[model samples]
Target: MVLVISVTVSFFWLWFIKRFETSTRLTGKPSVIFSLFLCGIGSVFAALFLAELEELLLSHVAFLSPLTYYVFYVGLCEEFGKFLVFYLAASLTDMTKEPKDGLLQAAAVALGFAILENILYSDWGLGILLLRSVMATTGHMSFAVIWGYAAGLYLYSKRAGKNKYSFGMVIGAVCTAAVFHGLYDYFLGMDLKPISFLLDAIVLSISVYILRSLKGRSPYESGDKEAVAEAIESNSNNFHLNRLAGVQALKTRDFETAAKYFKKASTVNHREISTKVCLLFTELLTGSVEEFEAYRTLDRICSSINVSNLNRLRARIAEVFAGCPDEERLLNLIDDLIDETGYRELLKERIAQFDKYANAIAGKGCADSGFLISDKNSLPMAYRHPSFYTKENNE
Candidate 1:
């Protein structure tokens, strides 16, 4: 019953912590589950690590005092152990794909470590259980937030070819967390009634501050434009496979199939522009994305490509506007929304592609959604869009 209650309380707090994080990036829940198991082992490893360090210190470093032992030894060893486990998880997989993921995964590892540590130190009293389980668990998780958020920001902000100062940003977090952990442990160890009372308010305040502060620092929020990532720093194996598949499907005029591949690719690596373009194309053709979204995505992607691809995208956008809206009004909207005058000039090229396609394929609307955009004509700018298709068209 003690163990059950401990786990139940920890679980409730874990969920409570997660409720504060508001990033929309989708990640696999299995990653968190895996971290739980990995960090449970890591807690055992931390115990052994601290034990050896203590013996080593006694033998050689008799100069070090007992008063500061909690800060230097216990805090560093435990934080280092958690860091190793979290690092392995991020490096081995795309566990830290989003900035918010750092917090989530870190919290999982902390909870796992705390739960196991509590289990080992179990006693018969409910007061002891609540103190160890609740206080210890929250402390571990709160300290973890320091490093977790930093690791995530480092991944997001570090451009391709590596940022020289990036290591400091990430490792500094661990050291910071270690110091905080030590101070927290040291304070609690004092056991004075006044100090203990003050520590509770401090812990709750710090946790709330850290969790709330993360909302403003989300990697997706720059310029009010949110994509999966800020930079395409990673080259994913699965992303490459899906990208190739999407390209092939696009060439074959299978827009629906193309979109599926691009969507999967985007999920694998948010930083990749090619995948975003492919997905954007599909959304333009099939999905009911807002007109502003359509214009915003085009403006963002247009300037980054070569003439061939730029013209391809430009011609498609012009064609879609020619078919669906007043070309003159949209031309002005394009000039207003897009930043570059030179880039806007490039989009002005007359390519009446979609109107002809719309005329050619009159009426084959899917019962569920979208029109069949498959081409029977050997058009110059042949490609597939994301959502526009039918059962017959797919066949």
Candidate 2:
């Protein structure tokens, strides 16, 4: 009954957190479920680990102060384990960009842990439930949310290529989260007399306030006209070139440049341009989650289109391109796209080429999302037209 009550309290808090963050880009169900699973597993591991430490404490190891013992045995090990769980869950999933997704996942896991811990303590009464809800449960959620939000930020901001600095930042964030978790636990464990809970409440409140303040308008604000104009021009110039150069780049396996050129071309306000280029580029360049930002930017650019059917069709195609790798998957996706876009003949021809290319690449779908990398090829200016890649290249 106590476990149930604890879970109930957690559920309400989770609901409230989700509700509050709905307007933000962080939202998803899969992430939440997976995070809870991680928490459940992590809690079991933590309990076992803590039990061993308790045994050590009872046995009396020489020169081991309570603070020193707690730091290594309780604080560091358990907190680090929880962060590890968060990272593991993220690395395995595709919804990595769903912003506050990490927070939800972490909170769920912590809540699951809290529920189990409450049950173990035999404090299933409403009073204990209420107490845990106000203090322990809230503490778990707050710490997890802090770590999760930082993970989300790191994941979102991370770019491709092996940079030591980038890798370090990710590692650093995880470690810092562990430190924060440790400090919280350590302070709670300390004999702070009557003011301990008050201190905790103040700390949690202050941390939350800081995090909320950290969120505001992005530097990549959607309303920036000058930046948008420059982006349009840059994309147009890149697009107004030959398809073979981009294709050759793919063949040579220079996916990053290929993605850049393809993206450049796709950005132009050109109706003659096939959204397929963007879709294909995204598929080839799927390694970087930053591609989602590009996709979102492209989507925003297309918001003015009268062709809702085409727009939705292309958007769905981009999504599939982001996830699937199998040639069969691409074929099925293309067929669905054609059916939706009412581009039967154009799509059929494209499909034939797509199939041939798929066969040639031998089931090598987009390298990252749909960006393919290869050696640079000299693409003639005349090849810029959408018709060029469709007709001449097939020959």
TM-score of each: 0.56, 0.47
Over 4 Å off in model 2, which ranges? Answer: 1-4, 20-42, 50-60, 98-100, 123-130, 159-194, 210-395
Q: Per-residue CA lDDT of candidate 2, range 7-78, in tens?
A: 778777767554434222321233255355445555657646755766676676667565555555554555
Off by over 4 Å in 1: 17-34, 63-66, 123-126, 157-165, 193-197, 200-204, 216-223, 226-395
Q: Per the 3 Å backbone cut-off, how many clashing residue pairs does candidate 2 have? A: 30
Clashing pairs in 1: 282-386
- What is each predicted model's overall lDDT from 0 to 1? 0.60, 0.50
> Lowest-scoring 10 consecutive residues by lDDT in candidate 2?
215-224
Taking every candidate in turn, the Cα RMSD to the unseen true structure, in Å, is 14.4, 17.8
Residue-wise C-alpha lDDT for candidate 1, range 78-191, written one tens digit per residue? 877787787777777655544666776777787788888887777546777768776777788777777877776665445333553476887888877777777777767776
Alpha-carbon error at 232 in model 2, in Å? 15
Candidate 1 CA-lDDT value = 0.60
